[model samples]
Target chain A: MTAPLLRIENLSVEFGPRANPIRVVDDVSFEIEAGGSVGVVGESGSGKSMTSLSILRLVPEPPGRISGGRILFDGADLLALPRNQMPDIRGRDVAMIFQEPMSSLNPVMTIGDQIGEAILLHQDLNSAQRRKRVLELLRLVGIPDPAGRIDAYPHQFSGGMRQRVMIAMAVACNPRLLIADEPTTALDVTIQAQVLALLKDVRQRLGTAILLISHDLGIIADSCERVVVMYAGRVVEEGDVRSIFRNPAHPYTRALLKSIPRLDDERDRLYQIPGSVPLAGSVTQGCAFRARCPLRVETCAVDRPPLFAFGPSHKAACWVTAEAAQARSAAEASP
Target chain B: MARYIFWRLADSIPTVLLVLTLVFIAMRILPGDPAIAALGDNALPDQIAVFREKMGLNVPLWRQYLNFLHGVVTLDLGRSLISNTPVVNLLAHHLPYTIELTIAATLIGVTAGIPMGVLAATHRNRPADSAVRLYSLVGYAIPDFYLGALLLIVFSLNLGWFPINGGGDDFPSRMYHIVLPALTLAFLKSAFMGKLARTSLLEVFGKDYVRTARAKGAREGRVIYRHALRNAMLPLTTGLGMSLLATLSGSVAVELVFNRPGIGTLLISGISERDYAVIQGGVIVFALFVVVVNLMIDLLYIVVDPRIRVQ
Candidate 1:
């Protein structure tokens, strides 16, 4: 619709020597509508984190670089924005909370000073106003006794409470998009639920779109309306969460869903995908998942599959599955 | 915090006593007799005996040690055997010159080193970083005494910019004489500090909190100086404490090369003359200096790093 809040077009992140660099994130494209939630689910090294980092242009250079990309946020191409002006957009328009709540907050700084820093950067609030705002933010994030605990350091807070402080800092400026890279992966299960709920609540209250990255499909399913499934630096499947879960088109998506442990009576051995996802840049000229896909054909090895549409908004990058869907659709049209 | 300081001060008593004991033993165990060194070699046996008894050396080993400890506690360090001046007076005269030299060198080192370190870390792998690293390497490799000689030759002999020897009289002349020696020491200390700062800053830069600082859109300068530098300073401060002790010891050689009238010269002359009270007093002062410095560093830890602060 009306120019999705954030659009990533042909984004590619590479590392290593320039002559034969390793591409960590290759041709990833996604969109997040304003006030919407999207999840990127992938195994470690699947480029999901890199893709998210590229959105903010925060990827470590030298070793890591955004080799090619257009990150259009609102109407501006964030990739093309002047380096000096990036700070204006970062905490103000788009903020991020990392996976590590333990080490993410500055150890030497008090929680009030840290959360207040985010406000201080973008908002032109004086120190008193900033302190008042920080206290409010702390209360909003469910931190008890915002007054007494404001001066407490990161070490004094529990893991869950620290994450809440991080959340408070992230939302200090009311960013339009919040990129959470495995925000709950380091938390206890109960804490994870609480954090996820807090994130959802923050989104509802602030109307900030969320780009959630995680290796947990269940988390994606529960938190996201739409999901992008990435494998070996490429999106293998993307669609509304319901359709993708009900009728997963990509073989990797099917494998991921199958691997989820069920509470009901089931097989003695837990299901596992047959092979590990290939290392980024390891698969050069083929469908990245062809080596592990059970339904892979000759064409899958010679040529990479593009995202082929199966429905109005659902797409899958799989030679066999997309071709089968196309032929079935053609037969139905002929009838 | 006061309790921590009190305990820290109390903790140094044992260390100070251990140093005093070691000094006492070293004076006794070493070969030359204080009687012969203080008096003349041709002195009669009766005269030597009188000198030994006068100096309390005729007492038993345990008794001498107890007397030495008692004198130290009561601020009664004995007179220098050669100069016949009170050990406190000698220390009072020479200690200020050493302190002045040390403070000057330290000021130069910290001011030069930290900024170079920050620059090198921020521009890592660039020409600036390589240049700073090279400077640090050279600084570490070259001995301060040799560097002092070279500086004297170049700046004093060739350039005629500074005097070759002697601690100068008056504030301005003292500052002028200090420049070369301070530079020689500062070169090495700054190199040490720069290397430490660069390493510490580099490590802090990679920390998750630093990345978080960046994501919050803090300007580069703010991220580096405010966030990364403060975190990096804890290790640097510890390193600084170590380096300060090193500089203290290093000053002995530099002082000899420069021929400045400092505690180093006093100690050297004391050893040659076997001035037991002078040597013992000087060694105790050094030991106490070390204790106070280490104590200050621990207290500094509380100020710089909140994690180490007493709850």
Candidate 2:
């Protein structure tokens, strides 16, 4: 089997002083295959975005530090790479798109200049060639009048168009992976669909692996083949998108699935989880989701459940799921 | 852009007129009469009366105001009450010295202060940052005259590296003699510029575009100079404009300490002698200089950031 493009092992990110650190991302592990897509879904502060930022080593320092992690890309440990060498790898092999499109772009720079910056950094293109590539990238993003809009400033573009320019910049160097952190959260519903469609088109055309971080399950389901569900900085469930959505193994994942407002369901009100995700570093023991988990067992308070496989590509970090899987496997083996 | 400049100039007519009127009234309202001041207190009452009548002091206040306004409109500033020299000629003679000192101070302030601010902001919370903050604080706290005197005592009196009096005769010598006064003004103003640059750069660094620049595989140096610095320049430009005005007016204190024959020194002497025409001309010219600098700053905004041009 071919090696996965990007593999993360026991990654942890901490905030504040080392002595009394707040673990924002705790022992999370996942992989993205070459030219494939993976979605990380969770509520705010669930470490979904932190995990993406950790991949790029872009987490704000002094306050944020990658305490423990092995980020292996192309069979090499990225964490062990020298700081000087990281810049070459950043826009060349991986690029990131941030939320808040209005603020993401440089206000003073022309769109053409901003897009050309990445090409100038990573590619050996001359000024003329860079200009051509910038125009092409702008055109590729479906921007109207790419030639005219090239000289336009950030404020000249609407929210969705600015996001498109951001996409153009991200894909300027033709990176292997694109880490999009809530790319559509700042856009309206219709514009969100358009941006998502643009992302899909970009991925398909460029054959770039996507590590999509978002809170919207529908977006994840629509865009990804596999999904990792995070709860309180830990991955509570990981499985193929269909399996996770069809049969969520972890109670937290199940609750999250239930909370989504359905057009078909004749409910008076939307379902809501009982409690919010615990603040970082606040929960030091037991299951992080037990406080809000409806099917949490007494053992959940005593010991943290390791991820147990339920099916070929499905795993959940819940004692109930683990025990049921164990009993089912035993019964099947006896028959 | 041309139309905007035209409108700005047209709008400044009222401001200039107001300044002229205020200066005229202020000169008259002062305790000492100009003729008396020119003639000295030892003069006999008959001699004082003859001097006052000759200087047109015996005219009605409204008529005198109208005469001054008419003289201003005709580009005639009359004569200095003490020396009897044309006020325009006096201004022309000393204006160069003040302009040279102000330009030198401004150059030093921008060149030194901006770099210091960038360094302090980039190395934030480090010893360098603390040192810059302390420097700016001291710069803001200390008066220019006090600092100028200290510089003179150290550089001129003690070291004897620079001359202690009036602007030198030759251009090279003038440049040399102006150094201490310029340094005094520059040091005070640069501290202000440095503080402004640091705060503006720090704020720009927090902006999302700076992060985007980093994500683009650009080097840290490129990220700061190319992406962050230009955005930071907007506020710095305003600070620089204000600094120009401060240096121009604030030079009065430095000129007194250094004994330079600049417009500031002339203004001080004019006030002492109660030279009404000289006072009126100097104040009007200084006000015009400020208005022009502000207009230039507005024009500079369009060049620095094209967004302003579109607006």
Candidate 3:
């Protein structure tokens, strides 16, 4: 069997004072195989970004620190590697496309200079060679009039074009895994689709594994083959896209799935998960998702549920999934 | 751009007229008579009257102002009351020295202070940054005269490196005399300039693009200079504009303290002897210098930023 490209095991990140470092990502574990796509769906305050930032060791220091975890890229412990070695690993091994494209790009620099800087830093290319490669990278990213557009500033480009430039920069080094964090959030719906298609096309051409983080269920549903549902700071559910879509096991996942507005005969009142993602102190013991979980039993509040795999692939962290989970699942599916 | 330059030149005309009017009125308003200095101290009222009539001081203030404006327009400043030399000739001789001094001081401040600021800001929270901060603190606290004296003692009097005091006999000799004085003035302004550089750079480093640069595997040096430092320098341009203003004004103090023969000496002597022509002409020229320097600074603002230039 082919080995998985990326594996994150028991990863946790904390920020604030050491004595009581606020746990932002708590024991989150997942894996993505080569050329595979995974979507991490969560709300604004969820640990989605923290998890992504940890992979590249790009978390801002002083308060934010990766407390515990093994970020294994092809079974190598990424967290153990030194910073000098990591820069090559970052853009060359795992590239990241940030959410705010305009801010992430150097405003004073031209589009060509900014893109060429990536090549100049990591590769041994002279001015003429880097210019050729930079122009090629701009062309490959589907920028029209690539020769002329290379000299434009960030402000000179429209919002969509700026994002395309950002995409071009990220893929300039040709990494295997691309982590796109809300890549389409700042764009209009039409522009959002165009950018998303550009990302999808690039992934297909390069055969790069993509960890797409988004709050938009439609984008996730359309883009990812597998999905990891996070609540508070922990993974609440994980499954193949078809299984998760057809039958969501955890009540939080169920509520989330139901909440997605379907085009056909949708209810006038859209379904919403009651209450917000729970506060840290409010759900200190047991499962972090228990307060919002509709299937909260006596055992759920006191003792957390381990992720029990019903099939070879599907897994859900819920107290109801015990020896009788398969029977319970079939009974529920029978209408 | 053509329209803007035309407007600026047109705008300057009224300013020159206003300054001419003010200087004419002020000379008349003062208590002392310029004719007194022209005549002997023990002269009678009749001698004074005769002296005043000959010197054109007996004319009414409005008529005197008109004559002053006419002379200014004609490019003829009448002879100095005490020296009996044309004010134009004296200014033409002394203005170069003051200009050279101010320019040297400005160059020194810009060259030395920007690097110090960049270094201090980049090395923030470290000992080097702390030391720069401390040095600048000491620099800002002390007056320019005391510092100039201290420098003179260390470099000229003790080490015999620079000339002690006096104007140069020639251009090269004048430059030798100017080194200590220019450096003195530069050193005074650089404390503020350095602090401005480092603080602005530090602030720029905190911006999002700096992070973006670093994330792209940019070396720390290039990241700070290309991405952070360039942006940081925008605000420093504003400080530099104000510094030019301060530099011209500070020449009076620097020239006075060092005894280098420039406008400062002319100004002080002009005031003491109450030589209205010398004082008025000198003040008017210095005022024009300050205003023109400010205009050049405004023009420089456009050069550094294209967006500003286009607007």
Candidate 4:
């Protein structure tokens, strides 16, 4: 089989000094095939955003650093690449779209110039060519009157239009991988749907792989083929979206599924998790989700459960799933 | 933008008029009379009366005020009570000196202070940042005259690197003489600019657009100078406007210390000699100069930052 387009192995991001660091993204690993879409869903501060930032090496230094990780893109160790060569890889191979569209764009710069900037960095195009490409990209992103809006500043555009401009800039270079960090959380529902549809359309047309990071499961379910559920900085479950939603193995994943307000359900109160995720670095031993896990066993407190295979291409970090897998394997061997 | 400028100039009319009225009232209420000051106490009563009438000091206060207002409208500042030279000519001669000093000081402050501030903010918490912070603090703490005296003692008295007093006649000599005073004035203003730039740059660095620039694979230098600095300049421009006005008016102390013949010196000599016309003319001119500069800065704000243009 062909290798995955991007692979992250045992990646860990920490805050504070090396002597006493606070682990925020702890030993997480995932992969995205070429032109495949993967969604990372977790609550705020779950290190989902930091994981994506690590891929681009954009995490703020001093307070935050990648303590341990190997990010491989197209068989090249991105983490080991020289600092100066990193910029060449960033907008050329991978690009990112941020959450706050209004703030993500430079207010002083024209939309055309901002989009042209990315093109200029990676492409060897002259000014006229760059402007043409900028207009073309703006049009591709479904901006109205691309020619007229080209010279307008970010403030002149609405929140949705600004996001479209951001998307145009991100995809301008035709990068192989696009990492979006909660790209639509700041927009209204109608705008969010448009942005999601745009992302899907972009992926289909350009054949670019997407690593979508968001807290909204519905968004992930609608857009991504594979989903990785993160809990307290660890991947609690990984599987196809349909399988994960149908039979979630990890207790945290189950709780997350339940917490969503269903349209057909007549329940008076929406289901909520009992407690918040523990602060980073405070959970020293055992499972990070044990405090919030409803079915946590005593053994969960003594030993951390590695991801156990629950089914073909499905893994969950839970003792219950581990035991169930073990029992099924033993029964099959006896037969 | 043109309309905005017109409105600003219109709004400043009352301000200029108020300044003129206050200077007129203060000149009359002050103890010394220009006629007695110029003629001396030894003059006879009849001679004093003739001098006062000739200078129009013998007229009623209201009529004299109207005459002064009318003369100002016609661009006639009258003559100095003591020197009898045209006040306009005196102003024309001395105003250039003050303008030159202000421009030099502003140039020094902006060029040195902005770079220092950028250095400090980018390398925050390092030795360079600490050093710049301490330097700006010292700059703020020391008064302009005290710093001028220190510069004079070090560069003038000890090393003989610059002249201690007197603005020379020729351009080169004037420039040579102006350096020490300008440096003294620039030091304090630069400190202020440095602080303003550092804070403004720091705040812009934290903005989301800066992060977006970085994420776009922009080199660090381009991200800072191209993207961050422009946004940072809005606040810095406002600070600069205040600094320009302050330096224009604050030159008084520095001028006295350096013994330079600028507007500050002219105003001082006018006050001491009871030259009311010179004093009034100098104050009005100074007010007008400041108003015009501030108006220019306001116009510049729209150019530097497009967000303000819409407002």
Query: Which candidate gets the maximum TM-score versus the true structure?
Result: 1
Better of 3 and 4 by DockQ: 4
Model 4 C-alpha RMSD vs. true structure (Å) is 2.2
What is the docking quality class of candidate 3? Answer: acceptable
Give the runs in model 4 whose Cα sits over 4 Å from its true position. Answer: A325-335, B28-65
Q: How badly does each model clash, as a count of residue pairs?
A: 0, 0, 0, 0
> B39-142, model 2: which lDDT tens digit per residue?
78788899999987766778898888898888877878888877889998898899999999999999987899998999999999999999999999998899
DockQ of 2: 0.77
How would the candidate models be sorted by lDDT, starting from the highest? 1, 4, 2, 3
Q: Considering summed lDDT, which 10 consecutive residues are worst modelled in model 4 chain A?
A: A320-329
Which of candidates 1 and 3 reaches a greater lDDT?
1
DockQ of each: 0.84, 0.77, 0.46, 0.76
Clashing residue pairs, candidate 4?
none
Docking class of 4: medium
Taking every candidate in turn, the Cα RMSD to the unseen true structure, in Å, is 1.4, 2.0, 3.7, 2.2
Give the candidates in order of TM-score, highest first: 1, 2, 4, 3
- Superposed Cα deviation of residue A201, candidate 4 (Å): 0.9
Query: TM-scores, in order shown?
Result: 0.98, 0.96, 0.88, 0.95
lDDT per residue for candidate 1 within B1-311, as digits (tens), equals 77876787889888878888888898788777878877778989999999988889888899999998888888889998877898999998889888888889989999999999999999999999999999999999999999999999999999999999989999999999899989999999999999999999999988999989989999999999999999999999998898888888888888899899998888888878778788888887788878878988988988998877746
TM-score of 4: 0.95
RMSD of 2: 2.0
Off by over 4 Å in 3: A262-269, A278-284, A320-335, B1-75, B167-172, B309-311
Position A28, candidate 1: lDDT: 92
Q: Rank the candidates by DockQ, best first.
A: 1, 2, 4, 3
